[model samples]
Target: MESQQSAGSNMDNGYVSGDNEAQMLSSGAKRGGWITFFFVSATLTGLMIAGWGWLTNLIVYLIEEFNVESIDATQIANVVNGSINMIPIIGAVLADSFLGSFHVVSISSGFSLLGMVLLTLTATLSSLRPQQCETGSSFCHGPSKLQSASLYAGITMASIGLGVVRFTLATLGANQFDNPKDQGIFFNWFFFTFYAACVISSLVIVYVQDSISWGLGFGLCAAANFIGLIIFLLGNRFYRHDKPQGSPFTSLARVIVAAVQKRNILLPSESKDYYHEQDGTSKTVATTPKRSFRFLNRAALKTEGDIHSDGSIAKSRRICTVQQVEDLKTLIRIFPVWASTVFLATPIAIQTNMTVLQALAMDRHLGPNFKIPAGSIVVVVLISTAIFIALLDRFLFPTWQKLTGRSITPLQRIGIGHVFNIMSMAISALVESRRLKIAHDHHLQEQQGAIVPMLSLWLFPQLVIVGIGEAFHFPGNVSLYYQEFPVSMKSTATAMISIVVGIAFYVSTALVDLIRNVTRWLPADINDGRLDNLYWTFVVLGLLNFGYYLVCAKLYKYQNPEEEVER
Candidate 1:
């Protein structure tokens, strides 16, 4: 009867222990599977379209509307990008610790709607923005303090809404599946949908913003945000909601505190000397803590007065379970792998911002009448990434596995991504060098805002390369973290990728500032500056970072080797 009840409990929770694949399959279909996937994907599409509509054209908006300097506009864009990525960690913590994913996502969507409305208002009201500079005029007025404050307030609210919802929604979607394979498939499709929505926004909404009207463009984003929130709420019945566990960080902290307090205690040679929790009771086990980070093992040491008469720990701060100690140790072990990705992301962040600036100075004419929007140029990357993710998941990975008799591991995928990134940087430098040559030949260097006699098509190859690289590493990083992190931190695990991207964008901002201050490589006018040299410098950095990643990957050991093999 207890066994039947346990099986029923597992069904309710959408997870089954052991080899109950048949039961999981049926229950998963009812709870999550393809039914919930459609709703989640639709919600993601609407939200992402709203997000990309404002974000893609921000640098141009800053320069044209506010009269901010070109470099300063890029810096501000970088900061905004960084903030958008960084804020997700906070949302993830909130989701995993207190408010559940559905609540967080719903609240964030409202914030997004409010933000987009304010942006639309700013675009509509001339008083909210400075006067547009006349053609061929040297003097341009900057935005007033009121204008800046209103703009920033809108940006802040929108960023919080967008960033918070980004990965929390992904987590919510993944929670529907009981099978790891389904979860993996969901992640791939989630990113594919994400990039596809961005591509649409870049082409359609961005065109509206540039060619039609900014007010209308922003109003559309607000509408999309509202629609997305409604769709998400509507799907609440089908969604499998996970209850928020207490903050996992507290357990991590307890491990450190307990270890420090027991610093003077002698190391135990027997497994019985350490405390282990089993079925909410202290139990003796044959398994001793691993030798690595031996000091942390002391946290689980059975000390006098550490336990109560009922076998529970009297003070959690002074004694943690072995599992708690191991969880902290897992994070420590993965730190180097995570650190390496930060450098990897920094170059990509720099490239994303730089590409927009590059497009502005190049000939963006497609045929005769339709000129490509400078901000929309990065859509090439999104389109490429989305296409390749579909191909890789549908064909490439399957073929590779069949031929090799093993699946492509996440580390291997990341390594391949590194190689492609390096190639992209080199290609970017070469392309920039040719563009500079064309600019010099035409003597366009002396003129500010001069378009180089070079086609914007030249930029596509490098962007496409970087996009392919992203298709590998972005999903790989998310998969790795999700698989390896403590079960209690599943939401935080997914958000770790966002944290990496956030730090990289901030680093990219600092790196750009450093370059501007130290070298003449990046000036306001790209035609007059050595933009090729900056790309070359990134190439060198990429090679060095790749080497560091290789070392880290080699040294790293998987916590669940069997699971990796199954993948």
Candidate 2:
């Protein structure tokens, strides 16, 4: 009787049948249990701790072990950061279009674990790294091309895995539940897990790296990655796997092609004239085309050769559904706001890369027993963001909703983030100005690699402000894109932020290079250079970006305003 019921259910998803039916259903029925969360979350937490352990302190590793210059190290770190975030778009595409999330994630995790092992070897084996350079020396023995390749190979492999899992996990985890409310809760919890894991990575892993040996620190990372991958594999029996439906990007492309091909054709006044969306071949009758973007409605206009004897498209070449046209229009409409994120992200990226260098050149001691590692300073931003998110979710948004009888919209939240981002840059400029003044008073310019008298903690306020800004914008941007984008493009929507961060980091790198070539503001030794001027430049750029964002935000309208609320 159980096997019979399982067979009936199997017809719905159409996975397997006959002899394997009972076996498959036994596991498949357990997919959505609360117990599955432990396996998935544990895997996620372990992977994050491992990845962040190495990634968070990348600059320090490059500068100290690889003998890279401070400015050069920051550039390298920025590139790595960009690559890690950028790779997720590819993972999301693969998950949504080709191989399902489980396969891609599992394969990616294997690569990640392998990379961690290789990186640990680099730390453990002296041959993998260049000799450390003496401080204040005019020269540095940077890693040889061969040695660099090995180190980078590991970093690249790890980054590829990290990137693939970043956005895909959310979708995979959400699939375990059918309830929309449960999905929302999962998304929030997922983000919280990442933040919490990074905090652990920063405090514990960074401490080990700084206070102990690099090999030991990376060895821990390798162990965690291995454990995470194992846990994920073990949970395979409890996963609800989605079948790949080919890339939705292709459908979007079809809409454009169809619309352009039929541009000269006139749209009929009757809604009955258009071909509404048809799922598979159930022939559930087409609905009327939406009135919006009526010009694109030509794409779905049923001509003589559009339908076959069985009600399928006879020529499946350039025709699209009304839904596809509308989806394309949704993408088109949200593009300006999406484009604005690149500029919005640029200043933040610039600050993050440079601030580590600043901390390295400032007093990093809180007391005789407690000294903060320069690289670990970035974690302050992460900590601040986590705290702010918790507060906003628990109290701030709820209070605001109670007072106004309406929750803050994604755009409105993003607007607030823009304000904070601009303010953060301005504050950074002021802090840098003070650091410069102190550097001058102490005549640290003569000392090539001297630390300024000012405390590195001065950098914290700007980072905290930036964190608050991210708390506003990051979720706002993510939720906005997720809710606004068509169902077919949901995974791609989540991956858009990665695209923004990747592009912004690269742009920040270019801006740094340009600044270095054009002016005396930035030098190999920042003590001899005008670091404050660079911060001021970021402030100006941020202000302009904020203005652009405001313009875009004002013009944008929510596609599903009723469905979204500040949970």
Candidate 3:
């Protein structure tokens, strides 16, 4: 039976009911539960991700120590990203079938922590087994064959651990709140908590690397995961658990079976045997050519519901139940919007790739005694942005929501933030172009031994804009994704967000390869000795992203939870 509404049941943004979701914010049981859940989840997951950045840096440093070619760094990066990318799909399936969010997250975090610990050993172990040098020969590297093999193995484990937990934690966090309508608030908190965790990791992790041992850096990451696990365990009673409704494969199979029984598709007797479910378990799950065709035909008919004016259906048979079919139809309709996510995501991807790369290219000279490390500025900017966003969300956003009347949903904020992101990139591109010209002029003057005075620090504006963009865009986009996707597919929803980044990364890789193969423009695009071509490329992409945002703003629809208005 459907539950009756109490006061505060109709939340503005549509995910949470007023009383039910309000309790999520206030009731000690619910509030403490979700707060503990999200805080630890965010911190742990952020550390896991940040650890990769730390690992990449360490690998580069290790290459220098070992006198190995830098080109080999690509191999390490591939393993990390590939492992990370695969985890969500695997974990999502697990969550949908055997394990729930908690188990998957806990298990994944354990693997992640163990991987980092092993990675830490990579450096220390290699240092202990530093290769012996011959008399006046080529430079010798550290690490034995066994030690190198162990390092690769550890990296894969760690990458997988990091990959799986993100999907688990996010979906789990969203689950803490019972009512669907309150998810808007949940999503806002979700993104903010995520960024907050990132802020802490970016700042603290840097200090760990700069001031401490490499092992300690990874150990810190492991410690964060351990803490997150402890937090979840301690507060498990407060949270609600949606037990896995059996495997999605089984569910889909049941759907197929039901459809076939209703004469929705033509299939041989053998085709029906596979989908036959005994309780929640299946004897065989085949993906044969004939079975595939039957599945498609049934799916097509099921989605195109036959409803008459009198609400009587005139069909040979119902392939799937109305509810199940509707869910599938919803997924199909949202496919185009999901496709647009890649476009919005391109600029975001630039944050780590082109922007981080550019940060390294900036002037490193920091007066006589001080030295600013490559990409340290980004850490500063991100931390600052997090602080600002916290203040904005806490003090400013609520007031805007109250005033706007039409609820300042995460989607709305995300759509609006693209403007700032585009402007940020445009400014960065223009500044980069000028900086290059200045550096060139200075270089020509210096050929005559004339000290062409220092190039004034003009990159600050671009950095500031980028920081502001990061604050607005990343959180908003994340929240928007969660808000739109169905609850049952929350893991898949978060995975969709991750996939956008994955596509962007692959796209960037492709573009770089294309440029390398086709053009000598790379050198020309650099300012002084710094890389700016890709930065400009990202800037144009950001503007194109703004157009995508406008399109999304128009096409997007919200799922309203307040049914009382119709009453």
TM-score of each: 0.94, 0.92, 0.73
Model 1 segments more than 4 A misplaced: 1-8, 12-30, 134-137, 278-286
Write one digit per residue (lDDT tens) for candidate 1, span 1-567: 111223345556564321134234443544555688888999999998999999999999888878888889999999999999999999988888888788999999899889999999889999999999952257888899999998999999999998988899988887766567777888899999999999999999999999999999999999999999899999876665666667989889989999999999999879888878732542435478899999999999999998887877787788888878888999999999899898889888988888998999999999999999999999999999999999999999999989999989888888899999999999999999999999999999898888897899999999999999999999998988887888668789889989999999999999899998999999988888888898888889889999999999999999968778777
User: Which has the better TM-score: candidate 1, or candidate 2?
Assistant: 1
Best by TM-score: 1
> Can you write out model 2's per-residue Cα lDDT over 1-567, one digit (the tens) per residue?
111223345434533322243344553454443566788889898999999999989988988888888888889988988888899899888887878778988999988988889999899998999887785466877788889899999999999888888778766776565444455556666676778788889888988999999989999998998898899899887666655667888877877777787888988777677766454332324666667777777788878887776667765555777777778888988998988888788888888878888998999999988889887898888888888888887799889989999877888888898888888888988998888889989999888889999999899999999989888888777777777777655567778888899999998899889999999988988888887788778778777877888898888777776566534
Ranking of all predicted structures according to lDDT, beginning with the best and ending with the worst = 1, 2, 3
How does each model score on lDDT?
0.86, 0.80, 0.53
- Cα distance off (Å), candidate 3, residue 169: 1.2
Best by lDDT: 1
